[model samples]
Target chain A: MKDYIQKMQTGGDIVSAITAFVEESKKINEDNHYFTVITEAQAIEQAKNIQKQALTKKFPLAGLPFTVKDGICVQGVETTASSAILKGYKPVFNATAVQRMIDAGAIFIGKTVQDEFGFGALGITQGKGFQAPKHPDDPELCCGGSSSGGGGFTKKIPGAHASLGESTGGSIEAPAAFCGVVGLCPTYSRVSRYGLLDYGTSLDKIGPLTKTLPEAATILQVIAGHDKKDETSSQEPVPDYAASLGNIKGLRIAKIKEAFAEGVDESIKNSVHEKLTELEKQGATVREVSLPSLKEGIATYFTIALSEASTNLAKYCGMRYGQSGSMNTSFDEYFTKIRTHHMGEEAKRRVLIGTFARMAGYRDAFYNKALKVRTKIIQEYKQAFKACDVLSSPTMPILPPKQTEAHNLTPLQHLMCDVLTVGPNLAGLPHVSVPAGKAGIMFIADHFKEEELFRTHAE
Target chain B: MITQDVLDKVAKNARLTLTKEEAAQFLPQLDEVLTHFSTLQDVDTEGVEPSFLPVKLSTEMREDLPEECLTQEEALKNAQSKNGYIKGPKSV
Candidate 1:
């Protein structure tokens, strides 16, 4: 990350560099659907501002360009979260993360595409008028999502660039793993979600997807902190994350026993185990530990996430913001019309399931039961952390699959892709996914212990 | 398990109008999803208070201070609006 700022400081021609970057970005967006909107004009404008002020010496992220997940607001930029219902709705102000990154002098590149409302793992669930992004490596393979564009863009961007990725359940990690980049999700509330279109209020977190671990950390340092605009944002002291990359020696790595069983691909297992062995040889201790409640992770996470999401998405009725239909109808019919015509198939399905879980009679059975299970899941994580500083698992059970595979799965099966990533999410622990072998390996640290994740990942 | 009748009711409650094709495709899938998630009931969560957030939270209030804010024009920029208010569907 510092390399880009250094380059901008010494390389007298900033305008030419930015122009080439935009040209390359346009080509990549066309080839892979990596960006929903490439802010070429905005990027050039910001570049000119940097050149005029010579801000590289004053700002940490000066001259460093960053891409935002579509779910995040970027002032006048169209932030649709890849959903048709929100099409043409440009926020008047920046998301807190975007504002902070800009404050640190990161130039806005563009908004990246993802599953509508972050409801899918395969990147195939884009709303109407948006195409699911293809894997950067092989177009036939699916890009992991819902931060699919962030993952792909980070990998494709040559140097000193980062993408701000939001995760509710493994969105950042999945795409990063598939694209072979560093996807790090901070603890829930670690980064304010002020301008983000909500998915699940309790679970959503904004973090970074970068080509290198240190860049991820550097971006997090800029964005993670208290924001009064977001009530849930943490007040915990922000650490110097870029400077906190310490040796992993003596750190305990507790490998989850359940993550490697049954359905995981052998290639994925071999890669993570190889990393574990490498870490052990580098003086870190590794042990097999079981968090049995994790077996219920997918269930607990989806139930709570969807339940919260159902309510959060209720705000997108046609009149106040986003897509609108003719107003010659009753409120109910108008809402139904706008939603029916604009929302995507997967988005509608999620709302239905979420609404059902929180309805009367079923509320106690599904939503409430899931909430209790969430507590149990958190307890299990706490128990495991008692014996270990960091927990280890494969980021995903399967490698990035064929593009067609995303279409074949039932809704039940599709959500299973997030099984390994949800436990840490449910408990609000910090987790990072690093490129391992064919996929990426994930490590979870205790709440407020993002330093531990960076330290161990530095190895 | 979710039935068609339940789905229709839930969809309506959620302000969604599902087509016959959508309902047909999702009805069974939603049922199976709920059945799969029913496994969470097997765990003993008796007496466990639900954890809405993993971290402790307290209400954060800033001084009741006036600050420059979005203009009405800017606030209504994304919405269908006229005469300084967002236009909406007819309400009783």
Candidate 2:
């Protein structure tokens, strides 16, 4: 991140930096890491424009090139969310976050691939002229997803600083961990979701996947603010997130016991424990804290996410937007056929799970109970915060699965991958996944407390 | 386990169509996903409020005022349309 920004400041040619970076990206992308790359000519043109502006004044992110996840809407560009239903659908406007990045002088290289409709965690659902992004470190390993491309490109290509990734249950952090980059999923309404294609309305958050903590903070500074377009966006004051990186002296850090519970790999647990111990050596008070409800967070997260997804995705029926079906048939038949044919297996499964969970007789048992558990989870976080300033956990329980292993896993097994990261997301706490060892440690802070996350992450 | 009839009803409600083979494959998978959720029943959430969001949210309404929106051409840009209208299946 600092590397790209330093180039322009040291009198280097912005166009040359971007052109070389795009070429490098293309070389790696040939291995199928990107869903789409802005044509070399288009990227060069945008770089030339930024060069002209550079002659006059400097912006915080001047000439930084980033990729938009396919789920994010970019005006006149294909934003497919890796789903065939919206394959050719080019949004007429940029998503609020995308527009903000452009306003900060960041160039949009192109959209990155992801799980179709952000459905799967392993990012195995690759379609629409692209395959799943290969893990940068190991091609044979899975790219933890649904923000797979953002994590892949940021780590694989230098001079390409950061990419925006939306998280619903660990999408941002999982990929960041697997790809060995840093990702911050701000408290649920910290960044506006005005332009992201809805996955789960309540759970979705737009964030940045970058190589360093400060870069994530810098990008967050640019994009985090209340937008009238997104009613869920907080009216809370936007702080200088990058400016608040203080030493981790005298901060209360809680190591979540459940985060290292049964299924987690021993190495992943040790790495996070080592980081917490190091913070303790640096004058931070570290203690073990348990959120019993953590055991139920994954299940509750899926229930609420899928239930909202089922209703949120109902708008994709062929009667309006998305892939058109047999128009000569009755509307019901047309809608059904388009979904059946164009939507992928994960999308179908979630829609069904969500539909049944919200059904009359079953609503009380599944959806309602899930919501109640969600409350308990939130309360648990609130209670834990009373005892500690920030909580620590492994960003992922295991290393990126082998590509073959990821493909062979069942749905339940796939969800188990999110066990560590989902709890903070469910509670709307601001968390940063920072590289520690093979995997990463997540610093989870109370709601709207992004500053503490950065301060702790710096240590 | 989820019965075939329940699976069919879910597909219909979701505006999706499924083949017999697809249904046969999904029933067991769906059953597995739901079985995972059975743990939620063990938690005593007796008097808790259903949490739709992690933070408190209040509905913020905007005044109905005219503003620039997608032009008709842009509105129908991604859909199959005729005469500037988005076309759909026959109502009959």
TM-score of chain A of each: 0.98, 0.97
lDDT of 2 by residue, A370-442 (tens): 9899898898899999988899989998898888888888888888888888898888888989988888899
lDDT of 1 by residue, A1-459 (tens): 676676677645567777888888888888889888988998999888877766435777777878999999999999899999998988999999999998877789899999999988988899999998888888988789999988988887776688999999999999999999999999999999999998998899999999878788888889999998898888999988755575678989999999999999999999999988988887899999988888899999999999999999989989877899889999888888888888898898899899999999999888999988998889889989999989999999898889797799988889999989999988889999999977899999999989888876654
**Residue A3 miss distance in model 1 (angstroms):** 2.0
Docking class for model 2 is medium
In model 2, what are the clashing residue pairs, if there are any?
none
List candidate 2 segments past 4 Å from native.
A6-11
**Which residues of candidate 1, in runs, are more than 4 Å off?**
A10-12, A55-57
In order, the Cα lDDT scores of the candidates are: 0.88, 0.85
Counting clashing residue pairs in each candidate, in order, gives: 0, 0
Compose the digit string of candidate 2's lDDT tens values, residues B1-92. Answer: 57888898888889888888889889999999998886787888877889878898668788999988878888888888888788887878
